[model samples]
Target chain A: MTAQSDQTTANADRIIISVDAMGGDNGPSAVVAGIAKSADKNPQVGFILHGPEETLRPLVDKRDVLSGRVRYCDTPDVVSMEDKPSHVMRNGKGTSMWSALESVRNGEAQGAVSCGNTGALMALSVIRLRKLPGVNRPAIAILFPSTNPQNFNVMLDVGADIRADARDLLQYALMGASYARNGLNLKRPRIGLLNVGTEEHKGRSELKEAHGLIAQFTDQADFDFVGFVEGSDISGNKADVIVTDGFTGNVAIKTGEGTASLIGALLRQAFEYSILSRLASVLAISSLDRLKKRIDPRRVNGGVFLGLNGTVVKSHGSADATGVSAAVKLAFKLAQSGFAERLAARVASTVELTQDAVELADPVPEHQKEGQA
Target chain B: MTAQSDQTTANADRIIISVDAMGGDNGPSAVVAGIAKSADKNPQVGFILHGPEETLRPLVDKRDVLSGRVRYCDTPDVVSMEDKPSHVMRNGKGTSMWSALESVRNGEAQGAVSCGNTGALMALSVIRLRKLPGVNRPAIAILFPSTNPQNFNVMLDVGADIRADARDLLQYALMGASYARNGLNLKRPRIGLLNVGTEEHKGRSELKEAHGLIAQFTDQADFDFVGFVEGSDISGNKADVIVTDGFTGNVAIKTGEGTASLIGALLRQAFEYSILSRLASVLAISSLDRLKKRIDPRRVNGGVFLGLNGTVVKSHGSADATGVSAAVKLAFKLAQSGFAERLAARVASTVELTQDAVELADPVPEHQKEGQA
Candidate 1:
């Protein structure tokens, strides 16, 4: 084991991650395999796996690395992909997803990981862990593969809530910057507001207002505001963190993923076109593998729920062992760094800054001023 | 010559497409070369090249295919990439972009092609050619590389006007369907309203209203409404034509382009990683070439400005010879199909249908009905 893992293992308080084991497409086996992989990598990490014990016990027993590192929370139900968030919120108490999050709520785990329905997960999280102080709406932040030195850029509001006013956007910038600081190890992440164009006059009124709000809080928030960034800059090195309303952010990321998938499909067809190219593919396997790894969605397979009281990493519903492991790794890292507490502190200061800026922008009349009285 | 080219060549009056020759990254040389390529392929097409004659004449003389097919309209001023649209609208009388649109305005050319600033081109087109009757706001439509049998899907309002209401979206659905009919030769295109999710309950209020408005007009609009589509559907076969607000559309396309470019860059790096990969790249040249050609933005380099009095194809400002040629070809095709007239007719009918639908929905209380008197 590495010295870092040894140090963590030697510590009295080992980090435990809450994981929903039944909701993923591959079921509890893949989730168990994923946790085993995480256990092999980090000796200090433990899992509070939630699922039907009969189904998950056998899978966990098969993995040697997970022998004693896991604790079970038996639950009968699973949140299917099609379950409505509202319906699930009311009736999801017996589900594995709810049990998984309960561990985090009860302080049994530092963070939670789930591959359940995103809507249900968000709803359950809001009801259980609750939103951070002064946060109007929580945002789902994702790591986009980019040209930055860090190899990824943080983008927020990828669809927690579709509508974000100027205040919400400002909070996203604050939370996203804090995410970059902890998640990507950036000292002072540059925050860019996503817009149709980079020009100040472009985009809607809310965006313009958000621009001013985010810019005003830069100094106190401890981040650089790169003004407005175009969609192209999401994967470019212009900013370390990109902020936008959930509606636009969700669409932009999905569009980017679709385009990448299309290119990959096209490339596969091209290589299989001829016998000579087939032979060439063998020789180019390592290089192609490197390329695939560089842009693999599986490697960065976690969408973090930001602005919440606790950290929750939502793995892709269709994630395999590799993807699930990546999510676990992310959840473990956030837990180790105490990201949620830091984020809460960052957001709390941001809310205070916003109040100050608002007062400054719209000064109270001298006759009605509270201090004057 | 092919039978198609011979048929066009034998026509009494050849189609003249106005070409703005000064603003592309490659300058007049690329524009002249591009038109020359178009001239060689389409015997029915001629060009009224707009720029300084001294600069363009030599370039045109060098291409034998362009020998009498090109007509120069000397305009001394050039619209630079950085020129503001508002400023250009007022002071761009003598510029190449303005002169190019003027040809279309005066019926000297059937359509116009510009490799100038998008804002300037859009601004000038609005001023010179004007909006088609009943078009609240004009939209810029582009063909995206997709998995459809046609290998392209039409997406619109990509930076034409950022704000699109339910009515504007409905109009876009009409105009986009009409474009697909002429441009892609789809008899009945499937129109999808771009949103954050495919569910009826998702997205903003305007999208929900647009869904209803578009569904009501499907039969009249001569298209199939696919309800709401997520950003992934842009390149998927779920819809043939995707309609969205300019802000979202613009951002989505740019994000797609950026992702594609990033993959291409990563592929290049992978090939150069080692000796084995280098040898493999040489052997796989044909395969790589095929893949590159399939996704090359240059091959699909035109954004058609719909809902205008005349068709205007906006080539990328950074477009090279090949890219410019694609724009000219699109302009010629649109001109040949009388796309402007057909689109205007479609929009006019859509407006009438919308009015009828509105009246039906809000029947002025029975006592105050229009026919009461």
Candidate 2:
């Protein structure tokens, strides 16, 4: 316990977070609220909320809580959630979101958090901070709600790139596993590829090829590769880390969110139908509360974009104050963990090995394929 | 209310159902229990439970209720949930699942319900029932739990074909809309194409192309076309029928299932943590019950395989007696509505119109390009 306390203190003192004050539904209010809550709890951490001075000043002024530690950076433009990705990347100079990214890039802040347009943020992060060496496309990793409160599952490429090859999937596995280990404080995280089925030939050609690559690496991989997992296995905690392309991951996340809300609404309606059932519902209130907290979206607010040179966290655009605060805390923890540096080194080593293997398999000409090796 | 009752009674009598007795966790016992319950309430409906005679005889022997209406078909094999699709299709001749499908095809039953291996069942149905002329792929459509109890949302291609083109999605929209009108008893079900955003250019190439087709048809089509919908919009009943490819749809449905279960588990834990919270939960029991009834998986047990020549409902493999019974009721509703015949005729007409339009523009290809022309 003492060693854990010391590590927490050491991490808190070294971490600096840059929050996009103009992002999300509640804007600077939620961002400021989250920062205030986090700062109050962790005295060693500091924050810089980027936005227009006039809009952000009052929110911070209302809270005398972290007046000294929480500072502000002025940026006139506010990027709306509906903005086009290319437009945001090209014209978002001096904007709050861009400035927040700049803070991480320039080393003024160790990490950044945003609840703005995901596409814009991804474009800006890659353009500004750049991808880690040997990483072709940076992927976003989200900790999806699982049955076990302490055993959350991480899904990668949750709307980063639409298309990914076998190599990209392999990189996602490595990055996601690393995230589970460092960010979630898990040792040798169990990784699984999200496929149509557990069978080797169950999915598309790309997945079949990826299965081979994953299988090859898992035999001697650094992490504990648990093999393929299906959609139903996600909530069952079949694996600590689940990896997939952005398209499937995005759809899966959205589906889970929609379904949970739908069920919750349905349960509410059922309880209201009759007086006798209402009485019975009262008897089952404890059971209901237990379910709510387990699937509370706010409790797991922040999702990190992996394979980047620095830490960048994305909160839901519709996030409230509590959600924003959680994002800030996540950003702080990630930055303090020194994950970027460790991932950079690991990825670099993997790339080197891959390059050497490719060179060894040097091809002859296309004409030689039929008769020569 | 009197008119609705009369119509429902008339509709119930015309419906014929074939149930797979060897399917599900509890097999014939649960199937028989559910059948007994339904048969007792609705004397007009007919049922045939297909399975091995020895295994099913004892389950039905004790129950005197609807003994005449409930008959059996001797089948040698049973398709387990985990059975390989190819293996089952090739080796499992005269299986309970195959025979149930065959009953529908032979006109002995209007529709069939199976709580068996979903993939294997789907494969058998596709091969035996055959697809409607002009239809490229058959899709699975399930009514999802919605925030509105009176109006549930429909999602298609939950686990049918993995790769789908624009035309297939267009077919899904049409079939789903028809199902919504018939199954949910809606006058004009609003159709929405599920994409990443409402923007025309937001999704993948397939979505972008599908969006154009939807826009063109919705403007002059028979149904109420409400335009695009996101993953978040599914639960809100923003659209009565939401259409997408099988892969995306399956992942989304599973995600929703997992998240709901996770949330329920969490709420239970919360209630058990302390006596005070448990007491508070009791006070809110009525609300919880209301919510549970609305989201009950059993209520929406049957999923229709659209674009097929005949009606086929895929019941959940893990379904209990209540769920199997609900599937039968849903299948009955679908058959009585004459939804398949109507949908078949509609598709035939649309395909003809599409072909005519293509032929008319064949001589002047430039005129076919609407944007340029």
Candidate 3:
């Protein structure tokens, strides 16, 4: 029938997502398994695995889920986590990470996912895809897991650049709102600007300026702007999107990770402190497992590099198959939603474009005549 | 017979610690309970409670621990948490918070502790006791719990001044190291400068200059200098003192508090999910209580403002009797150790004093500064 033919054609022309299948803590096998798992769950998704053909082909073929939907690019080199970004940018032509980005640039894939070095991946993406129009500094956005199981709070400028002016912050707010709409299915996300104190007159001068500019966009962007949130609001159920300069956001992320690890270690110590405690741990382990599942960092392991011409999801370097699968699924969703083009359109519609770094500088007015006493 | 008389006189002349007892969330009774608890454990400690004698005398008389070591400094006003610092400074003559600081300034007490408004307490202390000669901006230091049970890792510039230059950071290192030496009994504490990256080449220009300046003080100051540390090292045992500008430190501190609170909520939810889990929680209640006590925020409830002429410990405004007792204990330890004078001497020993905010501007010659050419 005509319906069967249409379905075959649709399957043949599936959305291809590229993957750098090497350089993660777990080797190429984990990457292949992750792709297979994603492909099984998502029939409309296919992969362009970028790694050595000999290494990837056998691992990929073992999975019945990835029979006809997989493709290989036959890359010779792997971008190791220890390799410097500058070095990779200059000398990494045939690396799997490089090939994956190239696939995105060549339009063979909608986006790319990499489990290699974050710095290297970012460098390669910037070099290949360039930045979107009206974006001064490209920022990395991440979904912070919240109380709501179906949604997450979006935070931007996580670690892309350490500095941000009022203009850059304004761009981040716009970009982050667009992301929330697409990724978290929010029609109008609430945005908050992070600061030391919540009082109206607190924080630095730049933050004050940013606050006014962000407030002006609430009506136009169809979002609610909650002014001057503190560090406590980042993890709590406050705003749907939290914005800050990269330096503060990056430090906060690392600190949260360290604290979570510390708590986990302390829990082990508590459970093993005595024989009776150990017995209690056995009975309570299932409840603890649910709690652990709720806060698992691996479930939300990808950092999306927003404001770029093409989307790139950077998986954690230490990710295993489960973590890698989570990242791949995120990439697939972004590609499926046509998020990059929508983001570009939204940014283009905004009037304020480039940063005012040059325009705002006082170019000491033309040789004023002074009267001597 | 001479030694016995001296002991009697020494008991009568115990070190007097001034406290603002009116404005804590738990009220004057909690403050009285805390002072009594401290007095029971420390016979050499005496308190000068500043509040209305009519309201406080009955509470003080209720405690057997406060029978002989208490003195009342009745004040007509109480500095509420909502009182602005500037308003308090201009019109807070007879306030209990003001009286406590005045006692420290007049040498009637060695140290002062308050669970009132932090900004008001700081303003009053700076106005009355003055800043140390070589100190440009004072900082608030706190002890974060760590791997070693005997000591804690010191973090400074928690929320005193939001801005800091290279010299200011170096000064924090010196002051934080001094605090570690006195508070934790570490002879030569290891110091680490907080940064976005661990590499020497990373972070802002001011941080780069601070790194070189701190390196020069290892032998003269008697400490180990770990080059640069990321946020993950804050709780880890990488260094004894972690120094940063106040803005970053304050945000990190609040973020840690928020995250810890979130995990606590999640843990409670996990344990209450079912009937069997609730029974397991009953059996494991003691172990969990010990774990909770180990990480209790109330246990370490004081933040000491360093680099001032007199030491001031700011307790949490909502502290209960146990929390107040912890703050009083910290105040007693600092007063007993004569930390203020030793810190002044240490700061004076360093030749590099105030921050050079203006002198270090634009070292590059004008000839190289081409714009339109």
Candidate 4:
């Protein structure tokens, strides 16, 4: 194995996660409970719970499993979900989520995990830790819950880059492929451009341009480019990684969330309407539960904001203890993999090639270069 | 009652629905089942099963309930979902779906029903019927399934009018309100702009402009405009009608759909893990079924394409018999309410006022007027 691979394996074995204890709807209690439970199961991993010292002390002291493994960082302020993204980025200096992120940026912790405001986390990351050298924008990549566990779909720019160009899309595809490789341990990640249809000439002008760019990357053997994927393909897991602008990705994820909840509720109602049907539902309860587990949001709460300088995992704002636990696990997995550094290195190398292509396509005049000097 | 309203109401009461028998995944079986079930319940309402005589004739004849109510329109061609929207609109002359839509356009039927390609339906509707005066684009308005049964949310431009301005959003809000009142029988629907945040000064510049226009309408009592709404508020039942450009709306709906399915599958997985859990799942199966019924896609499959000269209902592309039946029922309700005429009149009034406002704000110069002449 290569030295980098050895380091990754070592890091994976000794993962330390910085958890925002004061984040989410239920606060430190749920965070503490989840972290305590998780730490007990994973002896190789450690935790640094960031929150108000007073609040975290009692919770830590009460649990033997947590006290030894989990430490605290004194952060007084808690960034509420309702706070404006700009305001939080400016004023959240001492916030637990901010402090947790700082730990990751400073390399005190391998990864930062938070169930706080999404916009705030995104803005703070951009301002504080900064983007990877060649990354214009970082994308939030989520694995849509899938029936085939082996075929989880990675949807990028899920409320990160609202107005992304073809270059941004190319970066998303590259980053998503890297994520799938490291995070999901896929040998060859199939990259797909999420469009209105699967046709080569489908979608708006922007998507068409993006499709061409992705095709170019695939032709060069960068990743397994699977071409275009439609809205319906998301559920079917047609691609390992699906790329789109944040606006579309955000709405698509939300729509999927709403629809799944609606269907679950519909089935519940149908069983209630008649006694005979209710009994039949009782008989088929195992099958239903099996299906539910395959699509649980709580089980898959952590979504990594890829292309950042450091690993930053975002948990749902409405996440419970179960969701919080999953986020921590995801963070541990990401940190262990050394995925951020690998991605940054890959992007840095590609940037040089892309620059050369750009220069070749439209060479800058000698006079313009002299003027700059 | 006004002459138009009285005539429409009478027609609605005696409305004959022409269903595309060859449309949808389940084919004629589901269509026939839905029609038979509907005809048995609604004695006055009739149906025309449009498809190849061989395919549909036997299905209709087999059901006693469909004996007199269901007739046939001989159309051989079937527009597959995979077909191009433009091609289906231009060349699908004898397609069952096209024929069904034509039945409504030619006034041979009060309304048409189809569970075919949404793109094809939109294209055909725009090309064949022509848009209502002052309407730049026709929009699809879906009543999103909210948690509260009493307060369903209406989302407009759910895949139409890709590039929309403030004027277009205002028009959609007006049309959505009309649909809510007419089709849903909501007295006065509260309109909301689907925005990133609820703050007065949030979202893109276009949203700010649209917000101002909606506020103006609310002040004038045109409809109950309820300010802005975030993604989370969509299922919270805060607003009766949510208006957005089709691009965002389509993405949002699809995301919600994907997520809902994801969650449902997860829940299923959870119940099937172990024997003890399986027993617990069996005990809770009734509750689960009740929940499922509340979120049934079939119950909320039909979405009205508002701002047209006539009522056009788009069924879910993957809709079964119940979904098609709901679409037919929705069309009948809309036709009965005379919503199109009222909507057109309202929009015309608003357009006239807007023109006057523009003239007052920046009057055309003499040179410009002469150039126009």
Best of the candidates, lDDT: 1
- Show where candidate 1 strays beyond 4 Å: A1-13, A361-373, B1-12, B359-373
lDDT (10s digit) by residue, model 3, range A1-373: 0011212333466888889998898899888888887887888888888889889889987998888777778878999877888999999998999999988998878989998887789888989998888888888898876654444678888888888988788889989999999999999888999898887677788888888788878877778999988877778777888899888888877777766767777888999999999988998998899878877878887989988888899988788888888898899899989999999988887744332222233223344312311
Model 4 lDDT per residue over B1-373, tens place: 0011212333344677767777688887887887777777777787766788788778877888766566567877999878888898779888887777777777767767788887888888888777888788789989777865563788898887567787788788878887777766787778888876677766677787878777666644357877988665566567888889887787677656666665665666666677765775766666666676666668787878877666777888777778877887887776667776777877777776665444454478879877976
**Residue-level lDDT tens digits of model 2 in A252-322:** 78877887776766666676677765775676666666566556788688879988889999998888877
Which whole-number lDDT from 0 to 100 does residue B106 have in model 2?
A: 80
Docking class of 2: acceptable
B-chain TM-score, every candidate? 0.93, 0.89, 0.90, 0.90
Which of 1 and 3 is ahead in DockQ?
Answer: 1
lDDT of 1 at B224: 96
The prediction achieving the highest TM-score against the true structure is 1
Scored by lDDT, model 3 comes in at 0.82
Candidate 1 chain B: worst-modelled 10 consecutive residues by lDDT: B1-10
| Residue A176's lDDT in candidate 1 | 95
Q: What are the lDDT figures for the candidates, one per model?
A: 0.88, 0.77, 0.82, 0.76
**Model 4's TM-score against the true structure:** 0.83
TM-score of each: 0.93, 0.89, 0.89, 0.83
DockQ for each of the predicted structures, in order?
Answer: 0.75, 0.40, 0.58, 0.27
Clashes of each: 0, 27, 0, 67
lDDT of 1 by residue, A79-150 (tens): 998788999999999999998888888887889999988889999999999998899999999999999999
Error of 4 at A211 (Å): 1.7
| Per-residue lDDT of candidate 1, residues B35-122 (tens digit) | 8888888888888888888898889888888876777788889999878899999999889899999888888789999998898899
Give candidate 3 regions above 4 Å deviation: A1-11, A62-64, A80-87, A148-151, A353-373, B1-11, B149-151, B352-373
Per-residue lDDT, model 1, residue B6, is 21
